[model samples]
Target: MIERELVIVGGGPSGMAAAIAARENGVKDILLLERDQYLGGILNQCVHTGFGLEYFKEVLTGPEYADRFIKKIRGLPDIEISLRSFAVGMTGDKVVTFLKPGRMERVKARAIIMATGCREKTREMVHIAGTRPSGIFSAGFAQKLINIEGLLPGKEVVIVGSGDIGLIMARRFVLEGAKVSGVVEIQGQSRGLVRNIVQCIEDFDIPIYFNHKISRIYGRDRVEALDAVRVDENFNEISGTKFALKCDTILMSVGLIPENELIEMAGVAIDRKTNSPVSEELNKTSVPGIFVCGNSFKVYDIVDSVTRDSLAAGKLAAEYLGRARA
Candidate 1:
């Protein structure tokens, strides 16, 4: 078992920001663990612009924003980052067990930050009746495929949920020579920001159907088409409003849920509404030495908020360590 003054459970924007903040605030011996092969987290796959406006006073892409902080963290000699490290569980007394490339290791930390981030809800989670086909992709997954892997998800796409990711992907699909049929939302209005709606869907001449949802998907091995139906406020399908849309892909941007299995294992109290750790202090969790911020605390719409929230968490965690030593 390795002992550290601070252990951050993620290496994304929140984890990186927290480690930087804690170090600057006088804490040393910081260790950051990331499950992915890289340290940038989801930002590495987000290629479009519009990030870093609030934090950097300039517009940038997701990777650019994450890089700004990543470079800073790299220069900190006291911060240790472990890539491809999957945190399996945590003890109530603040010991964390993680699996690395060749071996599993445990770390006892004076203070812990849960910045494990969030995961997108898939087709199964939304209960859409459909053949389990190959053309379905979550908005984020599709983005990663195109941006990181240089692969196209489909030639024709129907995006469900008008959230920011869905809107962004609609434009991305169009840019990639794919035909976007339209974006469907079950709500009465679009859930994404007005700018994204205009810049991505509206500006691209893509239609957005409010109060509509995919009723069924038809295909044997891959997606060939799907049925969309208008729904009432109660989310019941309105009779005779179903329409068939020809598309090879269906991307769901329904919602995101915080990855909190480790939080639960540590016996941290979670907020039922947000499905994340309950904040007891400024950025501290119900567990005295445990803190949570960014998407792990709540699903944030933007990366800037993640960084700001993490800075507070890091500072508060440092204060906690100080008090413990005193």
Candidate 2:
């Protein structure tokens, strides 16, 4: 088993920032563990620009901004990063179970910080009536495929949500030679930023159907068609508004849920709106020495907020460590 003075779980923006902040704040022997091959979690796969406007004072893509922190991480002598390590479970008393190489080991730390990020809620959670088909996909899944894997998800598609991911995918697929017929939203107002609506969907001339949902899917082997309809008050169906959208692909951009399984295990009080650990100003979780920040805290409308929150959490975590020792 390995040991360290402090361990930060999940090597995303928050975790990376936490490590840097902790070390700079005078904490030594810091270790950042990630389950992915690369240091940046989820950010590496996001290829589109619009990140780092506030924190860096420059417009950058996800990877580019993440690279900025990655560079900083390498410069710190007190920080050690473990790639391809799964933070499987943490015991109630703060013993962390993680897998490295072929062995499962437990690592103990005086202070623990959870920077585990959020993940997309898939089609199954949407509860829409549909046959299990091959062509169906989540917007984030499609983005990962085309952006990172260099694979095309489909040539003709109908998106089922108007979240930023869906709206962004609408433009992404169109640019990749896919015909993105339309984007559907369950609410009258889009769940995404105003800029995304104007840039991703409206700029591409892709129609966004408001207050509509996929009532059913018509496909046997692959998604061949979709039945979209409008909704009224209480989300009831609006009569005589059903229309069969002819498309070979259907993308679900339903919603996002914070990946806080580890946080849940820690028994920290979580915010219902975020499904992540609740924090007032310091990004400290209900559990002391266990903090959470970034998208896992709340779905920030701006990446600037994410970075700012991380910086705050990291600094606060360092202070918490000192206080605990005192």
User: Ten consecutive residues with minimal summed lDDT in candidate 1?
Assistant: 317-326
Name the regions of candidate 1 deviating beyond 4 angstroms: 323-326
Query: What tens digits encode model 1's per-residue C-alpha lDDT throughout 1-326?
Result: 78999999999999999999999888889999999998899999888899999999999998999899889999998999999999998988999999998999999998899898898999998899978888999999999999999999899999999889999999999999999999999999888889999999988999889999999999999999999999998999999999999999999999999888887888988887678877755567778988888888888888998899899888888888883232
RMSD of 2: 1.9
Best by lDDT: 1
- After superposition, candidate 2 runs with Cα above 4 Å error: 271-273, 278-282, 323-326
lDDT of 2: 0.83
For 20-124, candidate 2 gives per-residue lDDT tens digits of 878888788887889988988778877889998888899999999889999999999988898988998985556788888898878887778778777888788
Displacement of the residue 104 alpha carbon in candidate 2, Å: 1.7
Provide the lDDT at 101 for model 1: 88
How many backbone clashes can be found in candidate 1?
0
